[model samples]
Target chain A: MKVDPRGQRFAAAITTVVLAAVLVSASPWLLALQAVVFAVGAGAGVRHSPYGLLYARFVRPRLAPPGELEDAAPPRFAQAVGLAFSLVGLAGYLFVGAWLGIAATAAALLAAFLNAAFGFCLGCEVYLGVRRLLPAGRAA
Target chain B: MAPEQVAGGAAAAAVLVLGTVLALVLRRRSGRFRAARSRGVVSAADEAAEGLRLTAEDIGAPLGERATLLQFSTAFCQPCRATRRVLAEAGALVPGVAHVEIDAESHLGLVRRLGILRTPTVLVLDARGAISTRASGQPRKADVIAALGRAVQ
Candidate 1:
């Protein structure tokens, strides 16, 4: 399965735009918009089209060496990290106020942008780091 | 800077540093330190017959006058696609050579039994149904032809 890099770029662009709109609008309506965008993007990713299937199946595997196959998928960790960031940001917004939440969100968005642009998976790196610190048997 | 703002900035910085350090330490300690092994090519005879559980009857039954070439592939395997193309071309070149592609995902148990850890594996069997050569990763055209020649000889 061959992955078209352009497809990934397009998906990232859509995710960024939707997320930005949600943050700027800061309204209940924005949540609905975000949900719609996410659903459409995820649906497209899973579509049977050649590019979509290729992106879903082959893109991430090509990132590593041939023999060093990933023991587990990376997206699961990315989702966990994303959820943690969202919760922390929400807490900061509710308790510390809008400015702090905005700052944290901006920082996170910047990091995500850099990662997508440069192919530097910060979340994966962090996950590997944490895995290393765990006692041998506990680490996955 | 206001005293309160300074405190806040310092706190955020502390959190960031702590998070990064913890992540790094954890990753390092999580896995066993294992050195990589060499990618040594295996001849047909060198392959463990018991582990493979693949006999001449199983492979030879499908091959009608033409020799049989079985290729194992994985979903996300780039080299596997390349190998498929190469084997397809080889099949065209050799008289009575047929290529069969197998998805490793559906046959994980077989893969484990064969001790196949990598994708794009090519298995060549002679007309008599004996395994001739087993190449891992993308095999060079010349090497594959040479192996076939040896098997026929």
Candidate 2:
């Protein structure tokens, strides 16, 4: 769908931050509802992200590289792994209570803000790190 | 559980669900609106003519001879629209303070020349045209005002 990486990242970050804020301020049931809403929103974003799509239609022939032109598709597995980490962080806060929860919440908040302000995905970095540790054939 | 606690829990749950749903719907709608395109390119020399190509001189003028608030925006930035409102209100509160907005899209060449990568960037310029502070996202009105005061002083 020709989604810009920057835009996708920004969306992801905003979603994560809002989710975290909801978790912090809302009741348990409310948090669950927010999680669902965030998941759907993220799913929609994934659908639109143009990570691998060709851009032949949008740009001039001279401006595009040879062969198929598609928008860059964000790495799905990588993004999923990032989302997973964010969930883990949130869950840790929810289950552990107070100090631990606040710590995890802070981490998630930092990750999200970093993605927004600097376009750096902490979750993606963690995913890549874990992926690197896996055996060759086991890596997704 | 106490009756009050039960009621509170239910209310909280309702608020959460409603807020999440509202946020989701808003996000979905906002996605349809794309950010604005960059303005025509400007040369290095042209950028030099203006201290910063992303900033507009007229808008940066002091607010009624008191304060100056400058907002850097792109044509299609939703947050920029919100930020503009906040600045306008702040301008109203303080006498002699002027709020200025610059469209990055309108001056794409200058933006590139100045190495701006993000839209809706705000820079509070002092009376002398030097940048006092810069914010990449929507800034709180109080923070902007405080920075402006600092810069003016």
Best by TM-score: 1
B57-95, model 2: which lDDT tens digit per residue? Answer: 334334335446666664334355567877788667766
Candidate 2 docks with a DockQ of: 0.02
Return the lDDT, model 1, position B32: 20
Give candidate 1 regions above 4 Å deviation: A1-43, A46-140, B1-61, B64-66
Those runs of model 2 whose alpha carbons end farther than 4 Å from true positions after fitting are A1-140, B1-66
- lDDT, candidate 1, residue B90? 70
Candidate 2: Cα lDDT at B46:
56
Top candidate on DockQ is 1
Taking all chains together, the TM-score of candidate 2 against the true structure is 0.35
What TM-score, over all chains together, does every model reach?
0.40, 0.35
DockQ of each: 0.08, 0.02
